[model samples]
Target: MQLLILLQLTIYFALVLSIRPRQCPKGLNDANTPRCVAMDGISDVEKNECRSAKHCCIGRNGYCYALPRKVVPTIDPDKTNEEMLSDAKDIMRSIKGGARFLNIGPFPSALLPYGGEDPYPGFPRLPAFVCHKRPRFPDNCDMEDKKALRYTRNPPLNIPYCIRIPCDPDLPELDESRTKCREMPGCFFDVQLRDYRKKFGHSVMAGVPVCQLAIRNKVFLEEARKVKDKTGEWTPYLNECLLDTFDEIIRTNHEGCKTLEMLEYFKHKPKIAGWKGIKEYDCYLIAGCWMTKKCYYPVDVNNVTVSASPTEHDDKIPSALYYGRPPCQKFDDKNAKSAIESYHSCLVSGCKLDKHAQNSYYNYLFDFGKSMDPSDHWVFWRLVESGKYGAHNLDEYNLLPKHDVTVTPFSLVFNYPAKPGESNLIDELLRPGSSSLLDMIKTGSGLQVPPAHQNIRDRFLEDLQGIQTPCSTTFTSFGARPCGPPRYKPTGVPNHCPYRPIEDKDLKPLRGSFEGCCDITLCYHPKEEIPNARSGAATYYSTWSYWTECSATCGKGNKKRWRRCIGMDQSQCTGRTTENESCEIVPCSSWNKWSRWSKCSLTCNSGVSTRTRTCKPIGGFCPGPDEEIESCNSEKCKIDRLFGPWSEWKGSCNPCGKSIYRSRECEATTCNDDDLYEIQQCPTGCGTWSSWSPFGPCTWDFFFRTCQKTRTRVCNGKNGRPTECQGNSVDVAYCIC
Candidate 1:
């Protein structure tokens, strides 16, 4: 019933909770309501009002206004328009005067809300407010105070303050006392105000754009031209002249209208001159004119021929007149022939007289008279007459004569004649007896000879049968063969000393034995003989029979000599035995096998001498059929067959199949009929099993069993066994002990 009630209560509560509406703050249910409603509304109102008013709150206090519209002066109840304009003019003057102290331009009068009239009438105005004086002490006022009274306050006199006032947009806004002037009608004045402010503000405040800079480059050029013209003789003026000439040339040469423009065209052209002197200026000028098509040839100032000639007294004679000339007339009109005759006479008497005499008189007249024909001579004389023999004429005598003399008869010619007694007249007068004389000279008669020649009788000649011959012959032979001795004969051998003199001893009488000696012989023999007979035989054998035998047998048998066997006895070759035997026999077959048979053998002995073998049970005892056993020498042991109950040997042995078993022996005893004893086998093999004897005669019994104890025995229980003992000694119960 409670659960049901609880269920009903839960159902009711869930239904009620489901019907409940989600709660929210008041006035926030509408989706459009802004998260910061009040703050957003206030900000929108502030923006709209501020934008429309063109004003902003001044730091928790007053408002700042935009620059105002300029108010034109108008007539009022108490003031005339002229009076108001005058007052505004005065105010501008006063403001300008005060701005001087701040080094700023006068504030634009348009920024003022009321032109010449005070906004607040009858108020005691400070000098700064009434006159728009610059601020003097900014430290004395807060920013709001300073802004509220900006036009009235004397701002700290500084460059920045001055700049700020002129450039201050807020200043105009403050004059209007509203920000709405941003859309006002008269705002064009603000732009003018801004521009004026920019230009004049920089000038007064920062000392920049002070005034428009005046450029007068043309003025400088005009001045320079004037100076140049003033110093006309200076180098600079000369250079100007050259430049101007060049400029004019270019201007004129350019194809354009002949006006200032053309002049300007020529002004830029370069000037060229030939010489660097005063003449250069003239050249440039001329070139300039030529380029401008206004040129003419220069006037030739230095043009005239200079005449030079000799006077009558200094006239020279013609060379032909000095060499050869026709005779001169005494005065063939000295006036008419003065020029010709003066030269002719001077040349005839000048340096040519000796030359004319040698060539005309001696050379052609006498020395070579008729050798050269008369016509040729006449031609030569004509050449002389024409002064062809003048000193400068080298071709006149190219082939001249050379004189030569010779005597006719066979007479002794002497450069100087001999003395009267020096002549040999007798010899000169002798006549020949015959055209070929010979014998008369042998009679030795009428022969004229000198005293030195009288002793030479052998040279005297005799005439015999009209032939002349010497009485005694004195022969003088050269390059002739000498007479040898009578017995000497040539042996058909050359002379040993061909150049030696022939002596008397080298010649001898002839002998008959040498009549036909034509042949000769030569012989040679040894000086000693052998001492031993065997040595003699060996010698004879080597020299005669052995060599002969060798030459005849071995030499003839083969071209090569026989090779003597090394280390063999030579006497063996001479042995007398029919059975053939070698001096040192060489076996036909190899002896390697026999040699190896005689050598000792080599073999290795056993390292270890003896080895023993034995056997033992593999696991200390012989096992049953289910027990494991192993061979002693095998890598893995074997097991015997198992021989125990299932409880005693629960697990099978290894592959050998051996298991352990328990055994017991009974003691001699008498049994009581009423007493009973249970026997059990021990789990392991039994060893010296004993128990206490209560009576005199002890009874021993045997049964198949296992030893067991029944007390709290603690053992490792994971395998279902006791972990340990609790009592001192537990009673043993035999099951299969």
Candidate 2:
């Protein structure tokens, strides 16, 4: 029920999710731009006037340009070449996954202080980046470089948010930001202008639709999750699979993020959500207090002790655990926006949102369970007010009344800090929600069906076409660069590397003609079509064919690889002709085994009890199936089978296909939206026939004197297509007219 409510309550999530292009939020608009002529009905004179003044930035950029930024070395221009190389090397060394000399780039003007003191710090900050410029920047002689990568502070420029496949907390620095083609959106992931200026030319096109790019991202995540499940970490196989998945998705929209059927399938999926800007997404959904600068959540979630009012002092207390101040950033940074974009689930609330998602509840109008009382169901729905709900949108906290903070359920989505005696919030949330943690994927990882790319509908192409002039790089006028690609191009690289550098040797143009650029990433079996020759034995075994694609995108599906015989001897093909692998791509709602007919409610205790199995999901009220069982006053008794309702009808009609079908949750359980419920017969492109009247009394024709029985039937033509009832509405036999 909660899931159903969430689906409906979030209007945009329901109506404009799948195909809508990313629209510039009303709050994010710039008046100096050409929005005056934004309306389709605007007069041509206005359009011309607006074009002369400025390109409209009403969600779509009126201009498309990839003008390059001036190159600045880590060291000053006056420094020796050796010094320049040395300092840049140190900066690179500080990063983890991306190689120091290869991928690290355009450093922030000033380095953010190392976050050694962050409440939940990962490995101590390493000093390799521009930290050399900071006063008293720590350094080690025989050192490992980790400096300059600070999570506690925002960078001068937007750093694309890394795509987290496995949710590794220690490797946030290694996200795909560096792997991207240098100049994004305009450059598309196809090429990086700044990075590849010397090697490959910068000419590229964002011809790929944002929709397709989003789908590729989703496929990578799905493959990433699968690889993690098997290897416990990222692997060459994962990268290889990613490359393969991308190639496949580009060809067929079947496994895409926006497939017609998949959108519907994912509407009820259990998603891992969190407030924007935080690193960890799987935090506990608990009540917390909000302030303009900081949100006060408990360090210990299981034993949450946060009060409505918390004294900002004494960091040791659970209530005092709040987000420490991050480096101040310009309100218009795209990195922050990317962080929010990755979690399209949070976009509606994020529109015009600030550095963090604090007062976003202002956008919503519906009443929700209040903070003071979890059971305050008497609340009524109301629009937040006529204005944007972002930090920039408001000059002070007064713009968003403090009292209104407790209204939306969003207050419950805080990032809880972990302590020695404290339990993990994620574990707590997952305990009752998931059957297996392995089935889950990160919220922002573009894998969820509808809501995944809901907000990424950047009608980039539409906007580009609207303006007659396309993005052509010019000397002075730089076309508006698009937001970076939401994901790294899935060409298969190592943790911190790009496809060209870490790709498979065999996959290269000349197949490893150059060194250090490619390696051996491929499938385990590397199955291919059966080779023609069997060299040695009388009847050698034929190798297996490639595994077929999984049967289902979400939920359980299967794949198979098969082999055949070489010679005339069929038996020699040997061990097995085929192989089967089960794939639970993404889990769907399912019932757990019915609890032993309630032993306490007492059937198992020799009294009448009920057996029930709940529909498993993180959110929403799942009504369990209950059946009364008799204990027979013994230790055990026969349990009655319980069932849930039938699922929606699925299947198509015409060309001798089943019109529709439906299945219910049974067996051990409880569970139609079309009923081709069988393939009986084609509808003859004709009207349905009604029963004929009893045979007319026996009558004899005057000429032949033969007694004949006659019956009449009616043709019920439907939808004004009475002609479909071809022959006639009535049928007669033997009797003269």
* TM-score between candidate 2 and the true structure: 0.13
- How would you encode candidate 1's per-residue C-alpha lDDT over 397-482 as one tens digit per residue? 44532122111111221111223354342232244442211121233122333333222222222111112211111111211111
Q: Which ten residues in a row have the lowest lDDT in candidate 2?
A: 525-534
Q: CA lDDT of each candidate?
A: 0.23, 0.28
In the range 1-81, model 2's lDDT, one tens digit per residue, is 223222222321111121111233333322122222212222211223332221121233232111112232233434555
For each candidate, give its TM-score against the true structure. 0.08, 0.13
Cα lDDT over the full model 2: 0.28
Tell me the lDDT of candidate 1. 0.23
In terms of TM-score, the best-performing candidate is 2
Q: Which stretches of candidate 2 lie over 4 Å from their true place?
A: 1-167, 170-234, 250-352, 355-737
